[model samples]
Target: QCIIDNVVDLKVQAAITSIVSATLAKAKLLCQDVSARGALVSCPAGYKPTGCACGMGCGSWDIRTDSTCHCQCAGIDWTAARCCKIGV
Candidate 1:
């Protein structure tokens, strides 16, 4: 009975792993970098901002409308965004 239960558990685990592998194989995380000469930068169409960076030694930043990166520091030289999307 114990051996049978172990075999069943192994089969279940294999099925779960197969499903996960197939899902991961079909999904791709695509990323890009976008930068601008001002305090704000926007990700390209169909992309969402994952993170932000600012020039002039500034670390204060936020995302606007889920697409644009806005730097909060004064006299900022540039702003950049790491954008990503899921693709097949």
Candidate 2:
């Protein structure tokens, strides 16, 4: 009886582990698929970047890329003041 109980518990544990592993693998695939699309492109031309890419409703503009004046901070404020520098 003890042996049978132990075997059943082991099998249940294995099954739970397999399910968790499969869920994690599926989540990984989904993330890869999303990232393949790439981050949002610079703010469309003519349209000045509104609301901090940092997500702040409004405040100072955190210049995105140095060359261009676009940014996608993903709502995360920049640690440094400058997002990008102008001129070669």
Candidate 3:
């Protein structure tokens, strides 16, 4: 009976550990996703838009005007800029 109890206790402990580990992994993923979203939202101009249609083709850069950095998108023309479809 003592050995049986010990085995049950070990199984319970293992299950609890698994749950805790899974929860931690989910939390970590959430945090990373939030961080990435924030970075994309606050990115400077000329940096590729996070979800732009043109992908890396839409070169992005930050133009330092006075004391602040302004984000700007780059392309061959207005159509090229439009092609990026930023924020769409």
Q: lDDT: which is higher, 2 or 3? A: 2
Q: Which stretches of candidate 3 lie over 4 Å from their true place?
A: 1-4, 28-88
Task: Name the top lDDT candidate.
Answer: 1
| TM-scores, one per candidate | 0.73, 0.30, 0.27
Q: After superposition, how far is residue 18 of candidate 1 from its true place, in Å?
A: 6.2
| Model 2 per-residue lDDT tens digits across residues 1-88 | 3798889899999999999888766652111000012223343333333233322332334445532232344553332222221221
**Residue-level lDDT tens digits of model 3 in 11-48:** 99999999988876665211111112111222234333
Q: TM-score of model 2 relative to the true fold? A: 0.30
Q: Which runs in model 1 stand beyond 4 Å of their true positions?
A: 1-23
Count clashes in each candidate, considering only residues at least 3 apart in sequence or on different chains: 0, 3, 8
Q: Tell me the lDDT of candidate 2.
A: 0.39
Best-performing candidate as measured by TM-score: 1
Quickly count the clashes in candidate 1.
0
Worst 10 residues of 1 by lDDT: 1-10
Give the per-residue lDDT digits (tens) of candidate 1, residues 1-88.
Answer: 3798889899999999999999889999999999999999999999999999999889999999998999999999999999999997
